[model samples]
Target: MFISETQIEVRYAETDAMQVVYHGQYVVWFEIGRTRLIKDLGFHYADMEKAGFVSPVTDIQLSYKRPFRYGEMATIRTWIQSHSGIRTTYAYEIVNETGDVCVIGSSVHTVVNKETFRPVKFKKEFPEWHAVYEKEKQGQ
Candidate 1:
């Protein structure tokens, strides 16, 4: 359906002693992908926060296939896997320059009231964003 593509250049610091990307770095890359995808859909995380809510990662799963070396370019593909009133799930793929899939993952998030830290229905808080997510999620 609707997919967002973002490019990232691996940095030396992101690698380990073997010059391969450390296992933890993939999580950061996933965030980058999520941020781009939301922006591409015409919404801003900061604005969401300013509106008195925050979307926190409630769950995350990552799987590594091949190794990604430092200094290599990567294409991160991200999409909304599912979106409901209470939660949104996003899927991700990180591929190296050679078109090899380096990792696949997904993250689950839910919006919470900023001050109370209580879960809230996204559809009720942001109808426009919910509409966009509903349309894009249909493609998945």
Candidate 2:
């Protein structure tokens, strides 16, 4: 399986009055991690759009463990967990620099025609990209 890791520093503004990072911020972090994962796989969102496709999250689930405070560093670990038809599921783990998992989550997305908003089968629209992800699934 292919995995991507990205580190981000928590800004003071991300924290609430109690100083713990706001719960909503983790969702944004998941997006950042997902984007990095796609880029690491040699695909860019802009290029995908230019090719007439856009992937949008269809579902999301998150579990928060330890809370992160401002000035801490977070490492987001992301991986493709599954794919079926036109949809793919990506999983993530956000850990503090101290090595504790602060949050675990997953997001499901489907590639669609940017203009029509109709789903596009991966093999039909991007065979090469589909092959890459298939190879990844085969323990590459």
Among these predictions, the greatest TM-score belongs to 1
* TM-score, structure 1 vs. true: 0.97
Candidate 2, after superposition: displacement of residue 109 in Å?
Answer: 0.2
Alpha carbon deviation, residue 46, candidate 2 (Å): 1.0
lDDT per residue (tens digit) for residues 1-140 in model 2: 98899999999999999999999999999999999998999988888899988999999999999999989999999998887758888899999998999999999999999999999898888888788777876667
Worst 10 residues of 2 by lDDT: 131-140
User: Tens-digit lDDT track for model 1 on 1-140?
Assistant: 88899999999999999999999999999999999999999999999999999999999999999998878999999999998879999999999998999899999999999999999989899999999999998884
Report, for all candidates in order, the number of backbone clashes. Answer: 0, 0
Native-vs-model 1 lDDT?
0.94
Model 1 / residue 25 / CA error / Å: 0.8
Error of 2 at 110 (Å): 0.3
